[model samples]
Target: MNIKKKSALVLSAATVMLGLYTGAAAQQIEKPLKKNTATTFAIVVDQETYNKAKQEINAYKSALEKQGLGTYIVSHQWTKPEEIKVVLQKLYSDKNRLEGAVLIGDIPIPMVMDAQRLTSAYKFDQARFGFRAAVPSDRFYDDFNLKLNFIKQDSLKAGNFYYSLAPESAPEIHPDIYTARIKAPAIKGKDKYELIRTYLSKVVAEKEQQNRLNHLMVYSGMGYASESQTAWASEQVALREQLPQLFRAGSSAKFVNSRMQGDLKQRLLTEVQREDLDLAIFHQHGESDVQVISGYPNVSFPQPSIENVRRYLRNKIQAANRKKQDVAETKKRFQATLGVPMAWMDDALTDSVVLADSLFEANGNIMMEDVDKIRSNVRMLILDNCYNGSFHKDDYMSGHYVFGSGKTIVAMANSINVLQDVWTTELIGLLQHGVRAGNWFKEQAYLETHLIGDPTFAFTAEGNTDYNELIVNKDGSDPVWKQLLKTGDADLQALALTKIFYAQGAASSSLLKDVYYSAADASTRMQAWKLLSTLNNADFKAVLKDALTDPYEYLRRRSANMAGDFGTDDLVPALVASGIEDWASKRVAYNSGNSMSFMNADLVIAQLQEYLKKPEFAGNTDIQRLIKRQEGTREKVLKEGKVMEDKKAVAKERAFDVNMLRTYTYHELVPQAIAIAADAAEDHKLRLAAVEALGWFPYSYQKDKIVALCDQLIADKNSTAQLREEAMRTKTYLLHFSAEKYQTVAKK
Candidate 1:
């Protein structure tokens, strides 16, 4: 059930107001329901689910209320998210600022369609099965500003505006929506409410077991990309810095899975069998039932445009076989002649050892059954990869391993958009707060939606952790800091700072400034920026102005995001003068084309566009010159790429550097710039790709072709809303650029 509404079934105030249901079998009493009242958290449940699980919910709400979380239980129609939006708006008015929300029941996440083409379809998680439509993000309600007047549904700006992204295919149903799998007596045969209740009950029990004997842990699986691919491969190295808050990581060597000594399953099972873990986190590739740890070699894989490369290799194997060579001899000849690394053809790449056989294997990695079988108390599990949250429908199958009978409350990305590096930093930061797993996971998702620009990742539990404990205490840290300050030990002090302020807590700005200036270590200094980004909300104007100019380019580049998130028009001069460089090598092709990734630069550009829209900065000569400078630089880069890519006469088994693309692109570019040029002529890649960026340039320079063609795209309702938005936004960008040339602001 995709939860599309067929008819409206409205429940009146009388039905909802009557609460505190007590039954002959039930000793628990439900409290009175609060509506239109201020509360810290909002729990939105569907009517059908509410009626079925009334007793369980009452007990749950009662528990939450006792913990200082005044709960608002609101029943909503499954299809009518607009009504839910109304409820949320009322809940988050000027009088009340909500901290978070828990969406209960099988509520439909209405498909989000961006009016601008700023986003791309994220189908990484479900790519294996060609099932990616479910970008089930709660963004629509979460970011609701509550001003949308939809009497005749109008522009997005008219209401609660949130980011929008769609998948290539529709996403599948979330497990919480329908019970297709799970055999746990606590979950199966019961409605989704009971199953979720069982899962929560398990979390409560697991928390009770955390007596400081259970360890907090991090798990990094096999490399999806090589060392050269710093964006993805740098995950573990980055995570190493955040692991200081956990216990005995230095002493517990066996629990860590840095080396793939055996199969991934056996290694994980061994860790679980040996000791209880309070938190277990993984950074790897995953599907609904499988996790990809260490990599075997996959660079030989060809992009769709270069399928001939596959034929080229297969022909070598066939020729050797025709010569009556043995199978091994033929494979060796093929490997030798084709020049594809023989190491890449290793059969074990998809073998039983490195992958999770949770769904289909005789005996393999932690499947659903293994959740209880781990033989130790496991509280929380986080799988940071694609489609990792999609639970399978069989009890003896994947469900046992996925949503275990509360063995662990999991955190994972529903759609794959490269979450490893981004999330590990955010996760470690949240863990410092020592918030309950559920609250911590909610914060993770909320931050992720902003940082990743995709609001599709999810936390399994909502409205749960209210322990209000801090993972890193000043008491444990004050002595270490005092010792470090007395000894003038920078290295030891850096470690102490990690235990004190890696993330999620606040310290005096004066104290943080002292640490920032005094710390000799760069990493320690960077932590100061991390805390400042969150804790120092005031004077961001002045703070960002100074930080963006820091000599550390990494720190300088990070300031782009910080400034963009909290900056107003006033910060434009500082951002432009900063001229920070970001790693813009995000590539599109492995065998076809490698070009400079325009991701970070585009963020900078977007911030500037916002400035251009302001009355004070709009059409200013200085701003115009800066915009032109960036536009010209991009044009030059594109032209250079065009020349280098044009040189590819034949598809090599390796990459053609659209200027060193072969070296650093690591076939991660998939294709050289020339291939992109070729593909556009064959298809529409180049024209479509440049539509938005080119918008920043003068239209006359492009002979107005972009404006005309893109206008047609905008008018074509048959085309996707995403493409049209891209077309119109680019037009808007160009008009802004054009108006600046004439020293006037464009009305758009």
Candidate 2:
């Protein structure tokens, strides 16, 4: 059979066996403990791609758990040889237990190749599903005695697919592999220039439609090994010449050229205007202490020399002497007087301490002064050079310094002298494709495949390569790429709903409503309503109104809950008003009733109060139960002298109630929760609870109240750790939420 047929057959057999196994172990599997039975997965990615993938994996794991799958996640970085070996060994040893493996970038391919070799040696079952970027050679399968599946597609083909799918008005083009090739002559002086131009034009067009181009930046660097000083200088000259050409026609578009020489800080400042620069690009050599300047002809000049070395030695000696002098003084003063002490051994007898100090100080000063200008503008640096993480004598170069005022997102080639230009090109292509909704890591993967024509290029951190290899976490989270692809519109409401549902089952009704409003389409709105329905009773009035006026019955039916808790009486009126009757009415009523009972309201009391003269609500069990519960609770509270404490407790409970209630509303939910808490009955305990719940909502509205509550909580002697934690969490949430909101609104 062909590969497709073989794959199908293998999958079918595996499914059948899995079913049988599950059936045989039904009793043992029935009570899948929330804990234990670790489901581990590994991913190999560069540092730049790690966070996004991790987030995506985490989200997917939660989604899977909701579907009743067990999962866990483990990550490893694979830059060093030793680290690679360790990850391979682990995968080999536990390959049988591994449900799946995902490899993310090209850097980890060699290591994965090694691990595949050891699979059979360790008796690892080849049947475990694996996903990777770079498609392994046939030898990978033959040598390991395994079956390998590769997901591959050409960029030009993908571009064609996109063209077909996009609107006709959207710069229509015929699908042809040779189109890029034919167009190459027009932009012939530079390699890949036509492709880059086409990609940029498409991106620019998309950005114009979206009215923003702040999300992505391209990094193009020196492509290969520097053979000599002349070759390096030539590369820099070529880069500088080409940069002006690339920017010639796209002057309106912002660009960050990586061709400048000297300190990164100075180069960045010179090439990029402060206000115009949204992203940065770096194209040079990097080691532990220094990044190469493209224009700098000689690497030897950039390398530190022994000049001013004696000062470092003298500084080291002074530091040691101070430490020794303090040893004889009082602990506090002595410790304080160590004068920015260095970390090293001190032996006064042989002046070893002085010698060591001098050497360290000398080295630091020399390196620091040489690169001071570059360091200043190297904000958000993306190192395209190899071995960027290597050590400089005693200290590491890559992770040593903070980015100062700006956030740093670095993409380093971990292997010694590895060419990152191919990876960089692929990254640019993927960015143009807009895969994973522009998620940085997923984009990296898509870019990798386009560049290398491989599906298993693993992107991971230095030591966590194995963890990165696993597409799904042990928790069964979806791959980062999948999540980003799903987030097509960057819907904040949907994201918030997901986060709340995963964290706390109940969200606010107002919040859900806001999500519905924010939705660009009926389907998205329906999805929001469906999620809302899961957490609380469906609002029948709202459902019927939307059903009659909105064009989607899917949303209407989705809004129909099988349970009732509160305010369900409103459904029948809504249905009647909408002219829906008979079976539909009956279904709506049934679903409404099913939904209302969970709201904890005295529906019976309202019914009795309304129909006492007619006796219509006399026998309503729901009404009776609600009335009894409310009255009993109220009577108990009034009779007890511990009203203060009870009131606070009730406030807290009510706060939770409001929080749960607001899960239905997408935008107004948090504010409503806070409002409910604020309006809660005057019991101090109740007030406190309400205040605490308000803190949990995104800190957008009622800032004054939130601030006052936090202050009060801090001062209150009665506050417990739980209350304090809630207060602190609210403050933090508000700070972050406000910042995000400001940035989003500012863009608008």
Candidate 3:
């Protein structure tokens, strides 16, 4: 047999071993596709769902076709993620390239593990928590570059297959096609098929009209970026540069903070109901079922403060009672700890006050039940929070927003907890140029992030560029992008830079560096920094040196993040100076402190000691506090490393502990981990974990040591299979990163 046939047979055997239903129905295209069509769209569904909602599905397909898309309906009784991926791959390779797809009804969900680097801060212990900690991702279908090793199908949940990133997979994500989920909520007393049918009709009706990206409503809730007003303000400044058309005369841009309104929940609902509202951005904490809208209310005077304390006490007492805890003891503890009067504790249990406080907290958030009551007119929503897009659950917050009595067509959110450090609005300007929602979302490159609802939806064009055509037709390697960089349009230039970076890899650093210094718009400069940091070359180091002091708060915050990863001694002086100068920005200050903890403890301490002698910083409490914090982290890491030497302790537990060193990316600990990894007497699991942890230190100054150790382990025939495998993976990652870092300068 040929190589392709042999590979197919092996894959088939693996699918059977995983218990995937191989005899299930295959994809059935609705009509013969035209080879000459410029672009194509797909609506994927299970056979039962397609059969039940055929009329509505056809109407949806017709609406897409009416908009000039070559739409196809692909129906299958899918039992494996590979089934759907195969269809998408075939469509993508067609003459009419598949631009976007929407997975409707019961399609396979891929749960990915061992690929934290592809995600924007989703790192869970797959060894301890198993399947529960795995990220439910659709990158299996969209990103062709990722090679997943199928683990198994979930024992309890059909159609949920678990896979791990193959050791040789790319370190980063760049999706080949954009995709979204349109699954109906599996809730009691509701017909899921009916829900799907009605949603399809809604999408069809909305496509008939043209909606411009003119009005934007931005809400910042509590506990996001520590409620840093500077982070909030800097985001708006970036927004202005990104969506210049929205900030022009006659367009509406309203920023509402949790502290700005007495009833923030009601204010949000009222704003979402506005017919003119095109996009609503919610930067807050969220669960699968609720959008957290408020923190403790800001109050003046002693009376309101007393009320707040009373409210908290009453809630805690009530919770204790429900848990069957000793209520008397709880109240006594609260009084003693808080120094509140016994009478106040007694008053806190007043039936009316307890009930009122409960109501206040509930009313402050937009719950899943609350979504049923609102008729939101916002065409698109970006839930910049955690678990709002958890479509794997029976019910989810983003599902409610899209499927409720609303005009909401799409929502971008995460299926798992997400990080605040991500550039959330990176390619948002593409919306103003009439790019489809999915096409723009594909550029985000986060694993847990997903687009719920219609992926092909777009706003009315506000610019001359047909971004839809450009995104679908133009290859990133095309020389035309280089020419487009000469254009004065900042957003367009940013787009060109992104394309060029993807095409040339680190070889594009010279152009990116030039743009970083020369670009007049903060948006372009910010974009340049974003792409340049990924290269990690000398230019990246130079950019970080300058950006640490750059006036842009967001840029400085990101620079601090990279400083922790790079952790070179040369950056310590500027890193400390900016940490002090940008201390007023809470997120920047937090990130700077984190970077200090990750850097060489001795170097950081020496710098702080010198700073203490300067008149400007002498006796500064903040500097003193930072010095203590860095020392404390170093001491703790040392103590943890000592535990790895304890043969009496559980080796598996020690392995888990060693694995955590990667979380801090403490370069100073790399050599210690290397020692544990190289020790033949160490437990196999512990040594393997140590080798895996070394991969996370690709940016460390001690990376060469890890590379040498990896080579030694790979060459040693006596090494255990697990140790050798992990060593090879670590070596691949370190070498690939090194190559990408310096490839641009090699030719020069």
**Candidates 1 and 2 compared by TM-score, better number:** 1
**Strongest candidate by TM-score:** 3
Stretches of candidate 2 exceeding 4 Å from the true structure: 1-522, 527-604, 607-708, 714-725, 731-748
Order of models, best lDDT first: 3, 1, 2
Query: 694-741, model 3: which lDDT tens digit per residue?
Result: 888877888889999999998898898778877877877776665354
Q: How far out, in Å, is residue 547 in model 2?
A: 7.8
Higher-scoring candidate on TM-score, 2 or 3: 3
Clashing residue pairs in all predictions, respectively, total 28, 105, 0
lDDT of 2 by residue, 574-636 (tens): 332222221233333333333333222344345434443346546656444545654564444
Model 3 misplaced regions, further than 4 Å = 1-25, 32-35, 648-653, 739-748
Between candidates 1 and 2, the one scoring higher on lDDT is: 1
Distance from true location, Cα of 565 in model 2, Å: 12
CA-lDDT, candidates in order? 0.41, 0.33, 0.83
